[model samples]
Target: MLDQLIENATVVDGTGAPAYAADVGIRDGRIAALVRRAPGAPADRAPDRAPDRAPGDAPRDRARTYVDGTGLVLAPGFVDPHTHYDAQLFWDPYATPSMQHGVTTVAGGNCGFTLAPLHPERPGDADYTRRMMARVEGMSLVALEEGAPWSWHSFGDYLDALEGRTAVNAGFMVGHCALRRYVMGPDAIGGRPGADQLDAMLRLFHEAMEAGAWGLSTTQSGTHADGDGQPVASRHAGPEELLALSRAVGEHQGTQIEAIVAGCLDRFSDDEIDLLVRMSAAAGRPLNWNVLTIDAAVPERVPRQLAPSERARQAGGRVVALTMPILTPMNMSLGTFCALNLIPGWGDVLGLPVPERIARLRDADVRAQLLRRAGSEEAGVFRRLAHFDRYVIGDTYAPANEGLTGRVVRDIAAERGMEPFACLVDICANDDLRTVLWPMPSDNDPASWELRRETWQHEDVLLGGSDAGAHLDRMCGAPYTTRFLGDCLRRRKLVGLEQAVRMLTDDPARLLGLRERGRIAEGWHADLVLFDPERIDAGSAVLVHDLPGDSPRLDSRAEGVVGVWVNGVRTVREDALTGAVPGTVLRSGRDTETVGTR
Candidate 1:
């Protein structure tokens, strides 16, 4: 007899075969038997895709629990391969917004900026390896300040901090920022690590891998800035230091690498590509890097760039797994940083207090001065890509710009007879800096949206980088899976359902070597999500202040996550929390072994 059975459901087995009606049986946290209906003539009126009825089988009694999933879909549980829950784990164990969706497994430590192994007693600790996640990843400094206790100081100690109990299963990549700070002190922050410091960092990497860290990650994207608007640690490191770290990760068995290389696109010459290829050959293991987004500018032309380091794998480089995000909902506040990535010199304005930012924006001299400082050559590129549309209000003293809630910045600028930048400043100052903005894509076109589906189907591309626990205010990539399903799979049918599910589940799981998770098979961990196929939709994103320091973050509730079980415990039953904490801090290459329910 099965421990539990779901009768009359569509089984879109994680493998991209075909979806069919079937009855699935579960026992001991695994799919015990695929109870197929007999051949032809509707044996017992069950679907033909249901496991073929055994010959001369005894009439069995009902399962311990019965789920009449007549119109539901059951596939492998979703695995979020990229997030920054390193600090958020302590306060919200369940990983909240993510686990509430179908995500059963999470991999944190993307972009190389994680909080762990810090030596706060050291002089450079506050500067080099710091907790201004708000600046880099949009994490709240208040949460980092008031919520986290400086308990552990090594990679292993950080793992220990996550051990015994956690909300959902997670694997971590040893952070580059923490490692550099641990080894090099302030020199690394200013520029590159010295030879001796590089060696120390390598040693630390080895220790972290041995301590069950999944891998290592570093970011070279210009977007990842310090609180003072400088590049983070790994961004400035010379190639030699990065090559050394790659070698260290290669030496450790069960390790991978993730790096963000936005500047690489601008700076890479042929020699640089050759060097990247060399690094890959040295690393041996696959590298997962911050990825390819759906670019609207040139459509699918892709700027003639070779990115996602894994693309270099065929040319004898490291397999930098592409961390693809299907959506880019540009979440921005009305401060100087509103769509700052789009607007050059805007992030600096955002870093200021509201009054100061407003003052700077109101000063025409400052604008003209900064524009002159930008110079013609560099300023041209900024103007082309920066769209004045899609800026909305996220917060305010009260709702001041309620009338202009979703209006584009261009419209506001035109109506107010001001430069787009000046209009943005006025909106921020007049509205108490509460306006938020996002890019509203016109439609899922074949070139962009279709490319997203095709890229995920790419055998080398790794489906991850939701930035789930980070990006508090503006973005909510956590719902990337649901959006992918609702838009690409269901709405447009760009990709089949089974293939899409596998991209979210087995792909990342297999990449991380998660043994028993991400599958619905016998003897596997019971991390499951049951949902209605037709009724599924990712609700729109909204802000909530549920964090330790009352930090506001975008969260989306899953529409069709009917049930979710973690390690045989129904952590989420009927789309609500059962509060059964059956998650563990999964080790690299050993992402199994369920932790006890807390």
Candidate 2:
């Protein structure tokens, strides 16, 4: 008897193959057979024999469950190659929004930040780590303080804690920051490790791989900082130390390296590209990186960024760029630290208590300084805050400002005969800092969207970078899966459904080395998604108070996901979680095979 049967579906198969009408059979947590129907056959009627089954065997009626997948697309569940769900897995095992978007597998511990391998002697380290995440990852301090158990101290211990507590297959990469902090203590923040310290770090890295970590993740981006606004530990690493760590990944089977090189925020220098190639050469395995977005304003940006991977491949190394398929929307407010902090000297005041912050906002001298900085290049890449017209009031608490909601700051400022910055300050003050605002997305232009479609077809690029669990309060990256499906199937129609499914499934699966997954082939693990192509998309992000600490974060729900199965168990039906935690914790060599260039 079969465990389940999905009948009458147009199977996209996750192999970039043409659509076919088939009935998929599942049993014992794996795909047992794919029974394709002949032309003009009845939906419920089966052929003489099932594909990949014995010649005499027949499709049986003892199946426990059956799904009528008529007019729906069946493809392998998505594998997210980049995320920061490391801590959230402890609190929300399914990695919500992501799981709801048909993601069956996720890789966390991105940007060189993880929650393990703590130094035994460092007391109060957990709090410091929590604060660092709060600052760098946009995680709420209260949630991190209340949600994570912080029980284990080693990489293996961390994995053990998550053993059976997930509904989506999860894996983590050992973080360079945690490794440095463990071995070098206070010096990890700003100083390079000496030879002895490097050896210790390498040993720990090797230990983590042996304990089932997928690989190593690190960052050298200028934007990342600890809670106190200091550069992260990975930024201090010299090229030698980084190459040694990459070499450790090569020594271990089924492991690759993930790094955020310089120029992630803007453009990469030739030296930076060379360093990335060297790291990949040291690993002798694929090196994947987070976030390559197209700025249509600059027509050459996409080609210039892709050129680095070409250079790396010529050097006997491989580098795959991860690009998101959607225009990310971020909802922000002054009550929280956000893009507003990019205004020069604003961080000092934003970090202060509410009373002091309110006083500082009312000060003319401070306001002038802020306006100058916001308009200057010193504001870094986030200088867009100077365009106050792009900000629209979202929600407010004060009655006096009730009518201002959804109004742009520039219009309000003009009517009041005040500068945009001063006008914004006055409004927030009247509301006691409880007004929420939505900034106009700079990348939401049509040119940018078309460029992303162009970039999607690039040979060295992979679709990923959904920073799901991180940036919880400010951004929701978890919905990129469904959002991209809408782009491919409904909106832009740049790629056909089969190619898009292949990009989301087989592409990342091959990079992560997940064998027998990421496809709808018989004998593969039954991680599948049944969704209507027309209705599939990430719905609008809305604030939800579902976190453990009553902390609010933007979350999106899937529109057309009919059902999702993990290891042949229905974990989601009709876009709702089924409370079935049938996921496996993937280990480096034991559970994964080698991933390479397609």
Candidate 3:
């Protein structure tokens, strides 16, 4: 008997195929049958035999549970290729908001940040790692401290801790920062590893892979800093070290590479491009970077950003770029560390106490120096945030900001007869640097959307980079799957629903070498989503103090997601979690196949 069945639904199948009416059956946590229904057939009518089954094999009554999928679209559950749900999974096993939006599987520990492989000799390492995550990833420190018990000491132990505790299939990449700290201790910050230390690191990497790590993730981006304001351990490694580590990936099965170099946040230099090519070539695995932001204002950047992928391919390697279909909305605060801190010379000023920071903001010379540095070439992608005039005031706690909420800084500045930047500073000053600022992106033009569609169709580009579990308070990227689907169905319509579903499902799954997943076929894992095409969307993000220690985060609920399933068990019904934990812990070479470089 079938475990569950959905009758008379429009099945897209996650293959970029045309939708068809079908009755899909699930049994033993796998897709048992897909009985096709005649057009306009009633839900109660018997269906034709499933393609793979004999006549009369799949009776409608055989299903133990029946779900009416009328007026809904059923597709393979979405796979999030990039996320940081490492810590959040320990507390919120369902990986909330993401699972709510139809994501059944998530790839975590991206950008070289993982929570395990801690050194038993160094007790403070866990604390340091937690603080680094809190600082670099915008995770609430209170939540990190009070949420998961830092008990696991190895990559395998961490995976074991989460094995059956989740409602979605979770996979993790062994992170370089943690590995470096585990092997080199405090000296990992700026010192190069000796021969024995390097060999030990390689051995540990092999151990992690054998223990079910998905791959290796590392970062060399300038923006990533430890809790102490020093560069993360991975940043200090030379190119030779990076290449050596990358080469070790080829020795493991079903493993790939994810990294964030200087080019990820900015433009790639010739040397950076060469290094990326070499890393992928040596590993014989596809390398994917975090994000590739498209802006019609800077049309030239599209080709420049994608150049490495082409170069890598030419060098017998594969490099894919991850881009978001919808612009992720983010709120920034001057009182905390954020993209504002990435501005080359503004960190020292912004890092000061609230009173001191406000005093410096009030100083003309200090403000001039800060603005100059922000506008300089070194500012890179963060330069976009320097346009203080475009910032829309969000939350304000001061009486002076009573009427400023929802107003743009430029308009307010003009009304007050002051410069926009100075006006922004004064507004935050009025709130004692606690004002919430939303910098409206200038690249949401039609041209940019068109370019994004073109990029989505590019062979080397994949639709992802949600960064869901990180940046909890300032941004909510977990709901991007629903939001993008809604946009494709109703709003911009730059891509059709079939292609969009394919992008969100099969594309990333194939990239990560996930086997027998990301599609709705007989014998495949029954990870699925049913949604109302007309109403599906990510609702507005709202602040909620739901994390451990009552820490706040921005969360959004899905609008039209009717049901979500993992391993044939329904985890969400009517846009709400059902408290079912039926997910698998996906491991390398077991849950995945080794994707070739070619």
Candidate 4:
């Protein structure tokens, strides 16, 4: 007898194969059978044509559970390859909104940030690690302090903590920053690791790999900083240290490395491209990087960024770029840390104490210097934030600014007979630094959308970089999986449902070497999503207080994710959670096989 049977589904199958009508049978947590309609049969006959069931006898079938998958598209569950769910998983096992959107598997500890390898002898070590995550990954400090159990110190212990608690399959990579901190202690932040320290980090990396870590992840991006605003440890690592650590990844089977380079947000120098190539070459594995955002304002940017992947490939190393399939709108303010800090001189003023920062913003010379720097190319990708006309005022603190909410900065500036920058600073200062600003996202333009479609078609690019659990208050990326499918099926239609599902499922599974979980084959794990093709979308974003410590984060509800099953147990039904935790902690070498260039 089958555990479950889904009848009348248009099976996309997550293989980039043509869609077909089928009745899928599940038994013992695997796809037991896929009973397809005979060739040239009418589509309407799929539901009534179960091979073993007789006519007019639906209830007599041996299947214990039957799902009327009529008018639904069933495919393998999404695999999110780039996320920062390391902290969130400890508190929310479902990794919500992601799980809600049919993502049955997630790869966490990205961009060189993870909470593990804490120094047992050092008090406040966990606190320091959590604070780093809070700052660098945009997790709420209160949530980290109140929600997570900080008892575990080793990477394996952390994975053990999540074993049975998660509702979605989870995997993690040993983080470069965590490894450095474990080896170098308090000196990890700014001090370059000596030979002995580097060797210790390599040993720790090996142990973490042995303990089921997927691989190693690190960052060379300037944007990452710790709680005290110092560069994260990975930023201080020299090329030699990074290559040595990457070499450790090849020591284990079924592993892949993740990195966030300066090229993620800016142009990569030849030296930087060489470094990525050498790192991947040393690892004998693919080096997947975070966040390849397309910008219409700069038409050449995407090509320029992708050239590194080409160079890496030509140099006999594999590299893949991760691009989000949705626009990335950010809510930022002067009082908080944000993409604005990536501006050349903005952090100096913005990072100050409230009183001093307010005073400096009102200073003529300082304001001029900051604006001049922001308008320059040295501001890199963040220069767009200076275009105040595109910014909408959201929240206000002072009574005088009550009417300013929902107004554009340029409009306010024009009415006040001042420049946009001056007007913005005045409004924030008067509001006691509580004013909110919504900037036009970089990837919202039509040209970028077309470019995204084209990029998805590229061999070296993968659909990912959702950053699902990070940047809690600033942005919501967890819904990207469904939102992208919505775009494919309901809006743009540039990508077929079959290809989109393949990109989200089998493509990532193949790249990461996760075994038996990305397809709907007879023996594969039954991680599946059933969704209405006409109505699959992540709705408009809203602020929600669903986190621990009453902290707020952005979230969205899925419109058409009807059923999500992990290991044959329905974790989500009717777009809601069933509280069933059937997820596995996917371990490299144990649950995965060695992956190489296809």
Maximum-TM-score candidate: 3
Ranking by lDDT: 3, 4, 2, 1
| Model 2 per-residue lDDT tens digits across residues 1-598 | 6888888789989989999988888999999988887766666532433433322222554566667777888999999998888888878888898999999999988889998887767866777788889988988788888888888888999999998989999989999999999998878999998889999999998989999999889999877889878999999998999999988898888999899976765567787888888998778888888778677866766776776689888877788899888778776666777877745587788878887888898888888887788877666446655666678888888877979988999899999998877888788888888778778777778788778887888778999888889888678888888888898877888788899999999989988899799999989999999999879998888889988779988899999999999999999998888999999899998879976533
Clashes of each: 22, 0, 0, 0
Model 1 alpha-carbon drift over 4 Å, by segment: 1-3, 38-63, 120-130, 191-195, 264-272, 299-303, 307-311, 321-325, 334-343, 348-353, 363-385, 389-402, 409-421, 441-446, 592-598
Q: Considering summed lDDT, which 10 consecutive residues are worst modelled in model 2?
A: 49-58
lDDT of 4 at 454: 80
Q: Name the best candidate (by lDDT).
A: 3
- Model 3 C-alpha lDDT per residue in residues 87-164, reported as the tens digit of each score: 999899999989999999999999999998998888999999999999889898888988898888989999999989
lDDT of 4 by residue, 419-502 (tens): 888889899999778788888664676777787788788888998988999998888888888988998888888788888899
lDDT of 1 at 245: 81
- Per-residue CA lDDT of model 1 for 1-598, tens digit only, reads 6666666567776767677766666776666666554433232323333343421221253456656666678777789878888778888888878887788888888788777777757844643344447777777778776766657777788888878567588888887877876776665667676667777778878888888887778876666777756677777777888788877766665677777666332333455456556666667766665554444443532333344344465655555445455655656564535334434565566567877876876899876755553434444333432444434434444454557765777787888888876776677677766655564554345566656655555556667778788777778888777777776446777767787788778777776768877766656776777887776667888888887768777888888778776665567766688776778888865653311101
What TM-score goes with each of the models? Answer: 0.86, 0.93, 0.97, 0.95
Which residue pairs overlap in candidate 4's backbone?
none
lDDT of 1 at 378: 43
Model 1, clash count? 22
Q: After superposition, how far is residue 323 of candidate 2 from its true place, in Å?
A: 1.2
Off by over 4 Å in 4: 38-61
